[model samples]
Target: MRFSEEVCERLDNYVYRLIDPRNGETFYVGKGRNNRVFDHAAGVLDVADDDNQTLGSKLDRIRAIKSAGLEVLHIIHRHEIPDAAVFEVEAALIDAYPGLTNLQGGHASSDRGPMNHLELIDKYSLPQFPSNPEHRLVLININKLEDRFDRRAIYNLVRYCWRISKSRAEKAEYVLAVVRGVVVGAFKPENWMSATRENFPDIPYANGSELHRIGFTGIEAPGDIWNLYVGLRGKRVSDPRLKHSQNPVRFWNC
Candidate 1:
């Protein structure tokens, strides 16, 4: 079903076509806001974290199509239409593609229902932040990490530290130390070790300074260690500490 331009303006809805990459078969028909195409591309809706499995399942179907070499085509429509009209559009779209099946249990035929965020949380054992007061404050800011710390940056830091440490525990310890230092605003060589242990007591810190010592001597300036620190703190690239003049070379060399 297509949307009238008037309806499109009010509804902001669209039908996404997930076609098999190999044969251009329309494998899935679904509707969402027009701007959610990027989330579709990134498989954000497919994240199986219990909070969003319903949507995730739908997204996974699309991913399967892509994996089979299909291209996704989005037919932008409106989201503000009456439930009857929205279902009619979806039903018509599915009818146009005979092979597609309604995995959403044909719920579009019923009245639109509101979803509860807490219900999702209860159903899915989603990860929650530590209850500790100090960590709780940091949890509020965890989402900010996505903007500053892209997957590539985190991967590079993890891999580099792992290679140098020769052990996973050592690698985790090293990374967490840098993370703590960045969060607590302690960049001094003398204070870095104690600060890490104080913030993350759960992590063993027999000699917290060892990681810093190795990082200062072994890695190059603005390497994984520095990037990891910036990522954990979710600091922008333009932050003052990242400036060439204020870089952590002195701490490393110390």
Candidate 2:
């Protein structure tokens, strides 16, 4: 939704709100120039592909709003402000609205505002990965066993069973990938709708298997102290007990 440079010049520097028509709720709030508001309104149909998931979910929400036969009401909260002040103002408005569909929130600032994504993650204690969680975390040993065939068994487990619980798989939060006693990546759950050729279509696989699902995402790695290392290490997902073990699916507790 690119606007001409001329239009963008005139529209620069503004914080906006999108009002839902069905129940008159404010589903989203954002700050931008060059028709960022309309971009959200227009992006409902372009759900994220295997390449990107962040933008697609926001678009999905907007599409749902439009599908309700209601249009979003765009309101300019403020305009003609200094570039630095925009972040301050945007963060304040976001803080005012307790629950907004705005996936990425306000930017960094010198004052109190919505915490940045990483801050929010730590603030809220996210990635509370538990190897023995009643939920799930599919720990993939970076290297396969010398005597094994492939990740078929681990795949079936992650795709089927819950981490700690004996019951079948259900809601799962994160999957921490470990390598030789070090945590390399943390993936968040995305959407895997089916088992078709397209099911979990976006994710890649070492075996070229279509079952390489895409419902999970790799997130930022934790601090060095939390990263797993050889010899006795920290607790939770960082435990080094699995350092020399061939087990692909290990456990971690928050």
For each candidate, what TM-score against the reference? Answer: 0.29, 0.40
**Clashing pairs in model 2?**
48-56, 130-252, 131-251, 131-252, 181-228, 190-215, 200-214
Please identify model 1 stretches exceeding 4 Å from their true place: 1-11, 46-61, 64-71, 77-84, 99-101, 105-254
| Best of the candidates, lDDT | 2
Clashes counted in candidate 2 amount to 7
For residues 23-104, could you state the per-residue lDDT of candidate 1 as single tens digits?
6667666666534554654456544322452455556766776686755555443355565566567655665665453443
Best by TM-score: 2
What residue runs in model 2 are displaced by over 4 Å at the alpha carbon? 1-8, 44-51, 109-111, 114-254
Error of 2 at 23 (Å): 1.2
